[model samples]
Target: MTQHRPDTLSHAPLGRESAYPEHYDAGLLYPIPRAVNRAPLGIEEGALPFVGEDEWHAFEVSWLNAHGKPIVAVARFRLPAQSPHLIESKSWKLYLNGFNQTRFESRQAVVDTLLRDLAHAAGAPVAVELLDVDDAALAVTRLPGECLDDLDIEVTDYTPRAEHLAVGEEIVEETLHSHLLKSNCPVTGQPDWGSVLIRYRGPKLDREGLLRYLIGYRQHQDFHEHCVEHIFTDLMARARPERLLVLARYVRRGGLDISPWRATPGERPPEPLRLSRQ
Candidate 1:
């Protein structure tokens, strides 16, 4: 029952080779306290300015049926932003791999176990949904609003610079997106490609400046959740939007994809729309 803090990154099985477990083992799940990153963002643990969740999609879920035959399915887990901790991505992959040889009576049995273990690790009630590999629910959809990738602009900076974000005097509401969002993994230093969507109300954000601000993350190293929070914080400070929503849909790595969204309170969150890249 030991909880992991940010300093425990070295203990995580992310950049190291690991022996895949052949049976169920919830111990593989590692919880990294959210406060570790929030503190740096000036976000208090209990007094968060935004309400949202991290939606995780796993495509390599598998386990043995009662007859010892293998059953495979995809899974979606919705972890609230208020959760005390966020499950480390690599540890989550390892935990799921542990079910490869485990047997369950029915799909419900598998779901119940997942609910119990994941909720315990998250320190919050996590929504778990298992769907057949070909379920229509897994259909891909496009990101809302306009794509900023086509904007002709120059970008020499690779590090995040919030000052690049500028808002005009005109007030408006719009959704903007960019597929060039890229950041490196803090542990592995591997690139994490994603599409970022920004929806906001208030002063109009300069599209070119917004793209530059996002492009600034190209060489940044951080987790998906932290990156989104950083963007949200920057927008609120520089653009001064009345209401804002920041969503990052990261491409899948190790058979898992994580999409984290943060929004001003009372703003309705969007559906977990699967992008073509996912």
Candidate 2:
């Protein structure tokens, strides 16, 4: 059950060559049911142990203004954790490309449309913001808390093993990060490089074991959101932490990057950051 349920992730667009559209087509967006992956993790949708949103950054958005002038800007989308669906990445890129030749009255109009379409697809009220290219704060932010990679350890297995999570006797609150989180895309089998940040308040997790668990994902294959949820679920099941937050930054693929944040209900994540490799 390490991978997504077959029937849950079925889509014609994925694992296929991209055929970009030249006009606006909300139909280009593909939605995958989240329940498929949650089921394997024993996560009941309503009784989820975490609360957070999936943050998406679109860096190659361009369209026409009212005067047929070209308009370009970066987009930030926040899809709540409660959302029943997660938009497929390839489909998302295709949907955004459809706007390349389309016309909009203003940037707000584009944002409004995105909010509507994405929310409709995700089955939740997704927040969307359009930022100017020169906006000082971009996705280039760094991970918060502490760097777990600072530990010197040995690595042998790349296979994901939840059993490696060992905890100390003391209760603690800390944020740990690692840049070795690597997983392949389920569709294309292409490598997805990511830096993960784990924050929790509970028994102190053994730094060495945590680092090994991250490295275990090296050969894992799945979508970014699913991978993060799997990590959260694995930690919760094994360590039984009182509170947890799993945030991951995957390098851009197709000019888009997805950062998924999942935390205990009503928890806010640390400030945004960009790892050196990102």
Candidate 3:
């Protein structure tokens, strides 16, 4: 492994030239300190405004057994929002690829090593699980709620505008979603596509305005977790909803997809759903 250390996302090796290493190297993983992006959201000091966790599904995990036979498994990692850092996606890919030729004593041992390594990289405890492809769920599902894409509206702005989230007193509960939630990577400027679902109670949010606000993220550049937190904070500040649940499911890049979920205090997260695009 190289001794180089990168401090920012742009300095990371995602868009840079690289080849897979021949051995397992824990140092291959890079972590982005949460404070870097959280600072801009005015959450640099105190407690986070929401409760949730970021879920990662790795679809391309493989390694070798003691007999030189190939072993394959899917991995799921859940990183809490309170973590001090988030693992860089490309670095994660490199780290996983490093395990290609390595042998483990047992699946549990592999799981334990992965848990320890990822948790250390994230600066927080991360829950991890390994599943066989035969037993893993593969159903393609859509976000549950009303589809806002059918709304008739004209959109010209492609930047986040908190003013677009208008709400009125109605005390009704509804779930709204849009498949047009797209953003760009802060480093490589690569387009990130995803679907977002908003479930809330209190004053009803203007569906047209909500769709416009989601569309505004077209040119936005930020991390997936930061984007979800940004949306949650915006809604809390503007609509003042009594209850809110925000989720962003970005498509898989580099054989991995990230799902960030935030909800009102004491609320359990919904079932994990896989989409065709994921």
User: Over the stretch 160-267, how does candidate 2's per-residue lDDT look in tens digits?
Assistant: 899899988899988888888999988788999999999898999999999999999898888899899999988888777888889998888788988998887756
The list of candidate 1 runs beyond 4 A from truth reads 1-7
Provide TM-scores for the models.
0.97, 0.93, 0.96
- Candidate 3 clashes: the total is 0
Ranking by TM-score: 1, 3, 2
Give candidate 1's whole-model lDDT: 0.91
lDDT of 3 by residue, 16-123 (tens): 888888899988888888888878878753588888899998988988877878899888889998888888899899999988899987788789989998887888
Displacement of the residue 14 alpha carbon in candidate 2, Å: 2.3
Per-residue lDDT, model 2, residue 32, is: 85
Shift in Å, residue 123, candidate 1: 1.1
lDDT of 3 at 29: 87
User: lDDT (CA) for every model shown?
Assistant: 0.91, 0.85, 0.87
Model 3 stretches with alpha carbons more than 4 Å out:
1-6
Model 1 per-residue lDDT at 241: 86
TM-score, cand. 2 vs. native: 0.93
